[model samples]
Target chain A: MRATVLYAAGDVRIEEVPDPVLHEPTDAIVRVVRSCICGSDLWPYRHMKPDPHGRRMGHEFIGVVTETGADVGRPAVGDVVVAPFMYCDNTCEFCREGLHTSCRRGGGWGIGGVDGGQGEAVRAPLAEGTLVTLPVGADDPLIPSLLTLSDVFCTGHHAAVCARVRAGSAVAVVGDGAVGLCGVLAARRLGAEQIVLLGHHKERTDLGREFGATDVVTERGGEAVARVRELTGGDGVHSVLECVGLVDAFETSLAITRPGGAVARVGVPQYEQVPLGRAVFMANITVSGGVAPARAYIEELLPDVLEGRLEPGRVFDRTVDLDGVPGGYAAMNERRALKVMIVP
Target chain B: MRATVLYAAGDVRIEEVPDPVLHEPTDAIVRVVRSCICGSDLWPYRHMKPDPHGRRMGHEFIGVVTETGADVGRPAVGDVVVAPFMYCDNTCEFCREGLHTSCRRGGGWGIGGVDGGQGEAVRAPLAEGTLVTLPVGADDPLIPSLLTLSDVFCTGHHAAVCARVRAGSAVAVVGDGAVGLCGVLAARRLGAEQIVLLGHHKERTDLGREFGATDVVTERGGEAVARVRELTGGDGVHSVLECVGLVDAFETSLAITRPGGAVARVGVPQYEQVPLGRAVFMANITVSGGVAPARAYIEELLPDVLEGRLEPGRVFDRTVDLDGVPGGYAAMNERRALKVMIVP
Candidate 1:
C-alpha cells in the first residue's frame, strides 16, 4: 500500500508500506478514497519536531471497506464509510452519554505512534462505532464533502451544541478558518437567526456568507467584541462558537457573549490563562465545548451534506492526488488553502 | 430614621438619616425588625473607600411594611416582608428570562450607594417584584430565620441552581462563611446526598454539619481536590459551590468539580482574573452562579426555613445592636463572627 509518512516536520513523502491487517476483532481495513489535511496538523508540520522515527500523516478519511474482522458487524466489504478522527467503543458509559471524544478506550488515529489515514489502505479499530457507512454507489463527487464529516463538520456541530445555540439565537463564530466556517453552517442549521463571522479574508468571508453568516466583523480581539455588540444591540451575542485555539479567539468569544449566554469553545486551547472571573462570572457566562465527538454528530450531519441542505464540504478549497500530499501540507501550513482533500 | 452608616474602614456608626419615603410609584417603606451584616460588607468595610457622603450598610433583612405608594400592590401596610439585596422590576425580558440580577430597569439595591437594609427603615423599589410578603405576623419569633431567607439563603440556593446540584449528587462547598454554610443547606435542599464542607474552622464545620454538610475537607487547594476526589470515588464532586472569592477558593472549586459538571460561584468576584483554559476545557467543566436573585427564591426557600426543614439562620453566630455595627464589621473581618444579625 502507498502511504504518506512524515519522517520529520515539513517532510511528508509517499512511500510503499505494508498493507494493514486486522489485529483486533473490532478492526477493519479500508481502501482510502478520500482524506484531508487538518488545521491541527499544522502544529507539527510548521515546527520542526525532532522525531527520529517516521510517523503516520493524517487522521480524517472517507474510504471503502476492503476487509473486516470477525467481530465487525455494521460495515461490510465494499461499503463506503466516513471514519471519525477518534475511535471509541460506543457501548461504554461515556460514549453512551455522547462524549465519545473522551472515550476510555478510544485513541486518535495518526497520533501518538498510531497508524494514520493518509494512505491507500488503512486499519480502523472499534469499526462499528467509528465508521458510518454511506449508501452503496454514492456519487464520488461528494467524497470530499463526506470526508470532512470525519472531523471539522462534526466539530463545528459540537461547538454549536456547546454554546447551546437555540432557535433564533444571535450567534458569533470566532475564527474564519475551515472549522469556523463550518461553525457558521452549524449555527445556521441550529436555527441561529443572526450569525456573525469574524475574519479578515474576503474569500473566507464570502464563504461565510454562503454558510449563513448574517454579519461580518473583520476586526480582531476587543474590536471584534465591539462589532458583535454593535450587531446585537449592545448586549453581545447570545451564543459564541470559538473554533480558533488561540488566546485572542477565546477572549474574543468571551468578550462578545452576553451575560447568561454561553461560549462554546471547540478550539484546542494552548497555554493561556482564560480570565474566568472578569469575563465569565461578572458576565454570568457558561463555557463548554471541547474535542468534538465526531462519531456522535456524523449520522445527523451526513444526510444534510448529501442533500445539499448544508455545504460543509465547500470548506475544502483545494484537492491533491496521492503523491501530492506534501504540497497539500505546505498549502495548508501557508494558509493558502482552508482545507486540502486528497484522493488516493 | 436611624441607619447603620459606614463612615470609614472599621467605623460603622448608628446615625440618624432622613426617613425613607416612597420615591417610586412601585415603592414601599419598611420598618426593619431584623437585619444582618453580610460577608460582602467586609469588602467595603475593610477597604473603606472615600465616601464623604456616607452610605447604609446591609442588604439582608425581614421587616414590616410601614408605608406603600399607591402603585405598590401586594405588600399592604403592616405586612411582614422579605426583600432581597437587589431590586428587580420582574416585568422586563431579563426578569422574564430569570436573569433578574440584570433587570431591564437597572434597579439593584444595597450595593455601593444603594439604600441598604441595616437601618431603622428602608425604601424598597419595584416593591411588587423585590419584596415577598411573609404569611407570619410582625412579632413572629421566626423573624431571624425569615431574615436569612432574604439574602444568604437565597444566594446559596442560586449557587445550587447554577451548579446543577441534583438528587444523590455529591456537592462540595468551598468556604465555611455564612453564605457558604447556607450553601450547604441549599445543597441539602437541592437533594445532594454527599455534601463536603471545605473549611478549617471547627465551629463553622459543626454549623455546616448542622446545615447538612455530610463530609468535611479542611485542606486547601490541591490537597482539598484530592480529598474531594477521594470522597467521590476519584471522579471529583458532581457539583461545587464557590462561596469564597479568593483565587485559591476559585481554583479549588474548578479542581474538585467532575467532568461535565458545574461549579456555582456566588462569591462576589471582587476584581480578579479567573484562569479558565486548561483546567476548565480539558476537564469539560461548566461554571455558573452569581448574586442570588433573592426576590426570585425568597418565596420558595423561605417556606422551608419557616417550616424548620432548613435552618440557614444558624449561620448568624453573633448578634449586635444598631450602634454595634462597627464591632460587627470588625468581628466578621477578623474572622471572629460567622455572621452578625443586627437589632435596630
Candidate 2:
C-alpha cells in the first residue's frame, strides 16, 4: 500500500507502506476512497523537527470496509463509511453524554502509534462505534464533501452549536480557513439573522458570503472589532464563532461580542494565558467552546450532507492523485488552494 | 457633614466634609442611615500610600432621600431608599439590555471624584436610576438587610444568576467572605439542591451553613478541588460561584465544574492572566461573572428581603457609630468580626 509520509518539515512523499489489517476484535480494515490535508497538518509540515522513522500523515478520510474483526457488528464488508477525526467507544460515559472528543476510551488516528488515513488501506479501532455509514457508493462525486464529515465540517458545526447560533442570533465568524467558511454555512443553516465573516481574501470571503455571511470585514485586530460593531448597529453580535486559535483571533472575538453574549471557539489556543477576567465579568459574557466533538456530531449532521442540503465539498478547491500529495501540500502551504482533496 | 476617610494604611478617621448638593438634573441628596464596611475596602485600608487629602471609604448605603432635582421622580423627598454599589443611568443601551454594571453613563461611588456612601449626606448621581425604594421606614430592623441590596446581596445574586444555577443543580461557592456567604444563600434561593461552601473560617462557615451550604470544604488550592470532587461523587459540580478572584480560587472553580457547566465570578480578580483556554475547551466549561448590576436586581428581590424571607442582613456581625468605624476596620482585619454595619 502507498501512504503519504512526513520525514521532516517540508519533506512529504507518497511511499510504499505495509498494508493495514484488522488487528483486534474491535478493529476493521478500510480501503481509503478519499482523504484531505488539514490546516493543522501545516503546523508540523512547516516546523516539526527531524525524525528517524517518517511519521504517518492525515486524519480525515472516508472509505469502504474491506474486512472487520469478530467483535465488530456494524460497518460490514463493502459498506461505505466516514471515520470521525478520532476513534472512540460509543459506550463510554463521556460518549454517552455526547462529548466524544473527551471520550474516556478513545484515541486519535495517525497520531501516536496508530495508522494514518492518507493510504490505500488503514486499520480503524472501535470500528463498530466509530464508523458512520453513508448509504451510498464510495465512487460518488459527493465523496469529497462526505469525507469532510470526518473532521472540518463537523468541527464547524460544533462551533455553531456551542455558540448557540439560532434564529434571531447575530454571529461573527473569525477566520477564513476551510473550517471558518464551513462555520458560516453552519450558522446560516441554524437560521442566524446576520453572519459577519472576518477575512481579507476575496476568494475565501466570496465563499463565506455564499455560505451565509451577511457582512465581511477585511481588517484585523481592533479595527475588525469596530467593523463588526458597525455592521451590527453598534451592539456587536449575540454570538461569535472563533475558528482560529491565534491570540489575536481570540481577542477580536471577545472584543466584538455584546454583553450577555457568547464566544464559542473551536480553535486550539496558542497562548499560555487569556487575560479574560475583568472583560468577561464586566460584560456578563460567556467564554466557552472547545475542540469539536466531531464523532458526537457526525450522525446529527450526516442527514443534511446526504440530502444535498449542504455542499461543504466546495471547500476542496483542488484535487491530487496519490503520487501528487507533495504538490498538494505545496499548493496549500503557498496559499494557492484553500484545500486539496486526495484521490488514491 | 461627617465621612469615613482613609488617609493612610492605618489612618481611618471621621472627618468633617462639605455637605452634598444636587448638581445634575437626575441627582438627589440622601441622608445616609446605614453603611457597611466591605472586604474590598481593606485593599486600601491596609496598603494605601499616605496622602494629605484622604480618600472616601464606602460604596454600600441605605438612606432617606432628603432632596431631589426637578427632573427626579418616583422616590420623593423623605422616602427611604437603597443605593446600588454603583450609579448607572437606566436609560443607556447597556442598561436597557439589563447590563447596568456596564452602563455607558454611570460610574462607581467612592472611586475617583464620586462621593462615597460612608458620608453622612451623599449627592447621588443618576438618583432615579440608582435608588430603589424600600417601602418601609428607616427604623425597621430589616434596614440592615435592605442595605445589602446596595451591594453584597445583589452581587451574590448576580453570581448565582450568571452561573446559571437552577433547580436540582449542584453548586460550589468559592470564598468565605460576606459575598461568598451571600452566594450560598443566593444559590439556595435559586433552587440549587447541593451547595458546597469553600472556606475555613468557623465564624463565616457557620453563616454559610445557615445560608444553605450542604457541604463545606475547608481546604484551598489542589486539596480544595479534591474535596469538591469527592463531595460530588467525583463528577464535579453543575455550577460554581467564584466569589474570590485569586488565581487559586479561579483554578479551583474551573477544576470543580463539570463539562458544559458555568462558573460565575463576582470578586475583583487578583491576577494578570488566566491560562484557561485548554482547560476550558477540553471540558466545554464556561468562565463568566463580574461586577454585579445591583440596581437591575433590587426590585426583583426586594419582596423577599422586605418580607423577612431572606435575612442576608445577618452577615453584618457588628455595628458602630461613625467615629468608631476605625475600630470596626480593626476588628475585621483581626478576624474578630465577619463584617461591620456602620450607623451614620
Candidate 3:
C-alpha cells in the first residue's frame, strides 16, 4: 500500500508501506477513497526537523470498510464511511457532551503507530464510534462534499457555533484558507445578516462572496481592523471567525469584535501567549473555539450537503493521486491551491 | 469638602478638596451617603507610584442628588440614587447592548477630573444614564447592600452571566473576595446544581458556603486543580468564575474547566498576557468577562436586593466615617476586613 510520509521540511513522499490490520475488537480496516492536505500540515512542512524514520501524514478521509474486528457492529465490511480527523469511543462523558476531541480514550490519526488517512488503507481504532456510515456509494458525485465532513467543513461549523452566530449577526471571517471560506458558508447557514471576509486573495474572496460574504477587506493589521470597524459602522462585528491561527489574525479578530462580541478560532494557533488585556476585558469579549469535534458535527451537516444545500467541496481546486502527494503538499504550501484533494 | 486620595503605595489620606460642581449639561451633583473600598482598589494601594498631585480614590457609592445640570432629566434634586462604578450614556450603542462599560461616551469615576465617590460630593457625569434612583432613604438599613450594586454585586453577576451559568451547571469560583462570594450567590440564583469555592480563608469560605458554595477546595496551585477535578468526578466544572486576576488564578481556572466550559474573569488583571496555549485551545475552553457593566445590570438586580432576596452588603465587614477613610483602605489592603464601607 502507498502512503504519504514526511522526511523533513518541504519533503513529502509517497512510498510503499505495509497494509494495516485490525489490532482491536473495536477496530476496522478501511480502504481510503479520498483524503486531502490540511492547512495545519503546512506548519510541520515548513519546520519539521530531519529524521531517518519518516512521520506518517494525513487525518481526513472518506473510505470503504474492507474488514472489521468481531466487536465492530457498525460500518460492517463493504460499507462506505467517513472518519473524523481524530478517533474517539463516542461513549465517553466528553463525547456524550458533544466534545469528542476531548474523549477520554480519543487519539489522533497518523500518530502513535496509527495509520494515516493519506494511504491506501487505514486501521481505524474505535471503529464503531469513529466512523459515520455514508449512504451513498464511493462513486457518488457528492464524494467531494462528503469527504469534507471528515474535517474542514465541520471545523468551520464549529467556529460559527462557538462564536454564537445567529440571525442578524454581523460577522467577520479572518482568513482566506479553505476553512475560512467554509466559515463564511457556515455563518451564512446559521443566518448571519452580514459577513465581511478579510482576505487579500481575489480568487478566494470571490468564492467567499458567493458563499455569503457581504463584503471583503483586503487590508492587514491596523488597517484591516480599521476597515472591518468601518464596514460595521464603527461598532465592529458581532462575531469574528479567526480561521487563521497567526498572532496577527488573533489580534485582528479581537480588534474587530464589537463590545459583547465573540471571536471563534478554528485555525491551530502558532503562538502560545495571547493579549487578553484590559481592552478586551473591558469590552466584554469572549474568545472560544478550538480543534473541531468533527464527529459531533458530521450528522448535522450531512443532510445539507446530501440535499445539495451546501457545496463545501468547492474548496478543493486541485486533485492528485497517491503518487502526487508530494506535489499536493507543495501546491498548498505555495498558495497555488486552496486545498488539494488526493484521490487514492 | 474632604475626599480620599492615594499619594503612593500604602499612602492614603482624607484631604480637603473643592466641592464638586456640575461641569456638563448631563451632570448632577451627588452628595455621598455611602461608599466602599473594593478589591480592585487594593491593586493601586499596593503598587501606585508617588505623585505630587494624588489620584482621587473610590468609585462605588450610593448618594443623594444635590443639584442637576439643565440636561440631567432623571433623578431630580433631593432624590437618593446609586451610581455604577463607571459613568455612561445609556443611549449609546454599546450601552444599549448591555455593555455600558464600553459606552461611546462613558468614563470612569475618580479619574480624568471626575470627583471620587469617597468625597463629600461627586459631580456625576451622564447623571441621567449613570444614576439609578433608589426607592429607600439614604439612612435605610439597605444602604450597604444598595452600595454594592454600584460595583461588587454587579461584577459577580457579570462573571456568572459571562460564564453562562444556568440550571444544572457545575460552577467553580476562584477567589474569596466580595466579588467571588457574590459569584457563588449569583451561580446559585442562576440554578447551578453544584458550586465550588476555591479559597483557603476560612472566614471568606464560610461566607462563600452561606452564599451557596456546595463544596470548598482549600488547596492551592496544582493541588487545587486536583481537588476541583476530584470534586467534579474528574471531569472539571462547567463554569469557572475567576475573580482573582492573578496569572496563577487564570491558569487554575483553565486547568479545572471541563471541555467546552467557560472561564469568566472580573478581577482587574494584574498581568497583561494570558496562557491561551494549545491545551486551552484544544479543550474548547472559552475565556470571557471583564469590567462589569454595572449600569446595565443595576435595574435587573435592584428588586432582588430590595426584597431581601440578596444581601451582598454582608461582604462589608467593617464601616468607617469620612475621617476614617484612610484606615478603611489600610484595613482592606491588610486583609483585616473583607470589605470596608464608608459612611461619609
- What does the interface RMSD come to for each candidate? 2.2, 1.7, 0.9
Instruction: State the TM-score of candidate 3 restricted to chain B.
Output: 0.99
Global lDDT of each candidate: 0.84, 0.88, 0.94
Residue-wise C-alpha lDDT for candidate 3, range B72-108, written one tens digit per residue: 8899999999999999999987888898999899899
Q: State which candidate has the highest DockQ.
A: 3
lDDT string for model 2 (B55-92, tens) is 99899999999999989986799999999988988999
lDDT at B46, model 1: 79
Give lDDT tens digits, candidate 3, residues A70-154.
Answer: 9999988999999999999999988998999999998999999998999999999999999999999998999999999999999
Off by over 4 Å in 3: none
- For model 1, residues B160-223, the per-residue Cα lDDT tens digits are 8889898998899999998899899989988999999999999999999988999988997788
Clashes of each: 2, 0, 0
Give the range of the ten consecutive residues with the poorest summed lDDT in model 1 chain A. A271-280
TM-score of each: 0.94, 0.92, 0.96
CA shift of A165, model 2, Å: 3.3
Which 10 successive residues of model 3 chain B have the least lDDT summed? B325-334
- State the lDDT at A64 in candidate 3: 95
Question: Which lDDT tens digits does candidate 1 get at residues A6-105?
Answer: 7778988888988888888899998888889998788777665767667788889888888998999989988999889888888776688787876778
